[model samples]
Target: MQATPVNPHSSPLVRVALLAYTFLIVYASWYPFSDWHTIGLSPLAYFSEALPRYWTFFDVSINVLGYIPFGILLMLACYPWLPRRWAALLCMLAGSLVSGTMEAVQTYLPSRVPSILDFITNCSGLFIGILMGCVLTPWLLQKDLLRQIRVRWFVPSMSNGLIIVALWPLAQIYPQGYMFGLGQLVPVLSNWLNIYLGIPIDLGSFIRQGAQLSIEQYWLSETIITCCGLIGAVLLFLCLLQPKAPKARLVTLLIFICLGVKSLALALLFKPEHAYSWFSPGAQAGLLVGCLMLYGLAFTPARVQRHLAIFMLTISLLVINFVPGNPYFTDTLSTWVQGKFLNFNGAAQFLAILWPWLAIWFLLHYQPAKSTNPA
Candidate 1:
């Protein structure tokens, strides 16, 4: 079917979104990114194996579904700049290239098993995703739905909300000392530097260990961190929402989404029986306080919201990074075995740890459009 031709102007947002997702896909596939020795066996040798035995539907489903975004995003990214046919062909070809790269790299990893069946499924998914994009783009682009959504729900010239919204759920995949504690990178970076640079170092731990905490102090720290983290993320998102938008409702929805992601992660990581184990007294207190804060500030101007968000984020990161890791949190980490899942785990942790900082940076540079859209 022919596409509905509109203006040929390319959206930088689409390009950025595509690149961000591409990085995630590559990270998910090559996670851990270590162990380089290889046998004489060709990486392509997997293609010659006998047909794959009965594989679980979950793995097959996830593999096929995961690549769909790659196709969709790639096609959309190219739609404005290239002919329709060329754009789609390039999109699928890029996806195939990515799949091939992942499979080839898996040959060196002792944990992963390279399978041609997986590659085939991925290609199929990419193709389907391209078709979906072709059908959907005409409506999404031609109808001006995204623009309407931006004006109604987001700050006119900013996309900080979109990026944060996407990362909010993915960040929950990693365990944090406090609820909504997204940026906790100092310790991890410290450890990495210590290992590679051969120095005993960790800025956060060093600062945190300066004072020992009692039971009450630990509880207080957790409460403060959680409250600040929650308030900061919500305000940051609110800063992106238009003044006329439903700030309270959207903030409520954001809170629910974050909690939902956390709950899902807990269920997956542990068991359904212990899914609620993360809801502690301190977290409950923080959630209550944070919601109150959101309600109070939901009426503030977007600029004021941005300033408050910056302040809130600065405090949250300082406390979270400076404070020692919760000893209680160690119990949860015990169940996590870094094997084949190491790569995915590592990537998720990186996102969870660095996310808040990324948001802060984005907010710092964010600017609202100077002119109003003509009616």
Candidate 2:
């Protein structure tokens, strides 16, 4: 008699990934979520409406690319609970339903136009994504080599920690005044208050109280933010990894990957001529100091690492938010092209704004358990 394979288990990471992507989709679709006056048109009118008169390959591609990950994540989340065929069907239905709902809601927004073509393109992406997921899921989650590797490398109960690590590079995609600075909420909040509430308050400036920061001071602030941010993020990764894991190699890879992501994002968002602009003198010094710190702390206890990560993150946040804006960084922002990647920019900004907070939360609350093979 043939032996039956053990039932695959669901991962909280997969479920959280699906939910996070869905939130991004909703946020991107209805971005700048203001001005809610009714247009007196049926939300479903797009179902029967003609294709948009003016459309471009870029729009179609964006619509498709946006939801491909949604489909892939949704199907992966379903794989443990349902048969493959059923999961595939459910992913298609869920992706289409989400696309339809977003389109319908867009009818109410004057800035956004609901389009049948977008819906069709989104469904096409979902179908393609589901196919890709089906092919990859077996080897990825079926108690296989990948599963064994994950089990061996990471500590137990790190589903969310892993997700945070994965998103660290992505959070760097959004431009920041300081390299690796992830959470600077005061300026964003100040802008929102000024724009929507008619309040004229620059919180960062208020905190500085008209004291003009010198070029040397600004450089010092940037260096502090960069070093603390990198150290905190790398230590978070180390805390989640097993004692036997390759800490130096993984940390090296992560730092390089984050820098590459930042460079590529800058190139895409600004002119290619400014691709390496983030490699400032302060950033270089911060990177060097952060690496030396990480090397020394490589063998620290996971609990100590977690606490240090929180402390570093807290210091970075305080400095980045209170420090006055750099004049040069403000000038660079004027060159950013937000025309085509509005949704992408919004998503990246969202990730950048929230990533550090999420990491700190994970580090504070995550309680590692004895390592064992996942069911």
Candidate 3:
């Protein structure tokens, strides 16, 4: 039996809902309402704070429940455009990325601590959302409310772009130590370059020495950031472009290379030690996989690329989890948990160990393109 297709017109509200839910989760995750201290509970709180045994139903429920709407709305927004079965899988992968980012951010928050259980719960919420969308969209289409809403505001061509623009700032939160914008990296890099090479570039020193940054530094940073944004937009545009336009592929590749060069140059000035690190074999492999995914998006008619990316990510994660090099990986799970049970700091350390692989996974699976032609 052929499945019914979702109306693209129905997507704007769904997108808005998804965005709202994402905002709420981010806000709530940062500001917990009922921690032990706030709730007049003991500092020796055992239920939520106890190590290893901290797997309470309350925590699980909250985490999972919080993300369910995110998953459902994302699915609704992408539905019929994204393959239905693949939508669920993609949601799970995306959910994991969001959970991972949220957990990473929690490290900096004084009140919040990261946890594996949260990851599990967030992913589960995405799964539930996908389930709900699969079942609910068809029924909703039979009603007049969705159609009425769609008529007023949903413009298919612009909706996805708007969503992407909204998400750009959120993506910035992933790279560590980046605050305000990429502008911050310039001064640090300028200082490093001036110190190491003994070349007197006073711009960096001036900023640090309490002198207001000259228009040059500010404009340069803004220009670089604007270029970076354009590169990213082009890449996404390429994904959505018709496969017949081979020129789009070339353009996207050029944009990517340009951005890579720009990033490398900035890194050299700011952190020379890590500037070439992106070229390391593991990182290169991830890059290759990402390129391949993009190529698939351009050329493939079937939606297999999405599933393939998900599979690759899952396999990569499994390898990272079980590989022997890291002490966390080599140590027995029981021993590791016993040593730092229920502590956010410990969970954060654990996450840090796995983050490289997780990053690689996202790179491999990151698809900004809307799949218009369904398999």
Candidate 4:
């Protein structure tokens, strides 16, 4: 008799990933998180309004594209329980409901508009996404390709790594004060607390320009930030893998993937000419040091590797947050030609500023049992 495989739908990784993404979608659609004023305005009224005349390709495209992953992930999560066809249909329905609810809520916020066009585009995006998921799941889920990949490439217990690695690159889509120094959400959090709860926490670390860095000092600081950031990310990936998984090769692949994502984000946000502009002298130095660090630590015990990842991240965060923004480097923040990018920008920023911390928290919370597997 053939043995039955474990149900993939019961995975904590999938459930948590779904919840995290849902939270992000909700938060982005209702950002600023306050100033909610609904003076005799029915949120549903926007659905009956005419199409938006002032929409741009960027807005429409993002609206359609942003929820694709939700559909894909939702379908994946529903597999092994619901039939594949039902899962895809349910994903589309859920996406439509989320889009509709977000659109309706937008009516209450002065900063956001409830647009019929946005609603339609959002649903359209979800539909395409679910359609894609339906096509891909046949080979990916049903054929047990996901299981094969996981068994071959990852530590059996560390399914969480899939979500982390998948998100790691995309987190770079948001602009950062330091290259790859993500999860610097402290100042943002402080500001929100002060405004929302009258906490009055001092958040001057973000703005207080202390002693000016000598040209060399600036480069050295930048190098450390880059090195620590890269090493921490890679080390975490290494720690999550099975004993026999390919380390050196996978590390190289991960590095290339991150670089590609960063390059793509830079190109899309600014001119293609400015894509490599992020490769500053400091960042270059950091990359070398970080790689050396990764080489040394790659074979460490998994528990030890986790400790090192946390330590490196803590040091990097301290240095990056303490240092003020570079005056010499110019950002294209004010030059955005249209309003279409605003929502997308906010979502990416939210991810970039929060994912690292969340990753760290997950690592800290996870205590492996005595079993040989991470599961």
lDDT tens readout by residue for model 2, 1-375: 122243478666778788877887898888867787688899998899888888889779978887788888987888777778878888888889999999899888887888899999999888888988887677677856555666788887787787899899989988898898789899889989999899999988888887888888888888999999999999999988887777788888988899898888888789887789988888888888988999888888888888999999999999999888878889999988788677677778888999999999888898755546444
Best by lDDT: 2
Model 3 TM-score (2 dp): 0.35
- Candidate 3 least-lDDT 10 residues: 174-183
Q: Candidate 3 residues 75-183, lDDT tens each? A: 7776646556666667768777777777666655556666656666788877887789777766665354665543332223534433443343333222222111222
Give the Cα-based TM-score of candidate 1 against the true structure: 0.86
Q: Give the TM-scores of the predictions, in the order they appear.
A: 0.86, 0.91, 0.35, 0.86
lDDT of 1 by residue, 246-348 (tens): 7667777777877887887777676675567668877888788878887788777777877888788888888887777777787776875444244478778
Clashes of 4: 3
The runs of at least 3 residues in candidate 4 whose Cα sits more than 4 Å from the true structure, single-residue gaps closed, are 1-12, 185-209, 330-338, 368-375
lDDT accuracy of residue 208 in candidate 3: 46
Candidate maximizing TM-score: 2
Q: Please give the lDDT score for candidate 3.
A: 0.47
Write down the lDDT that model 1 would get. Answer: 0.76
Alpha carbon lDDT of each predicted model: 0.76, 0.84, 0.47, 0.75
Clashing pairs in 1: 31-343, 32-343
Q: After superposition, how far is residue 22 of candidate 3 from its true place, in Å?
A: 0.6
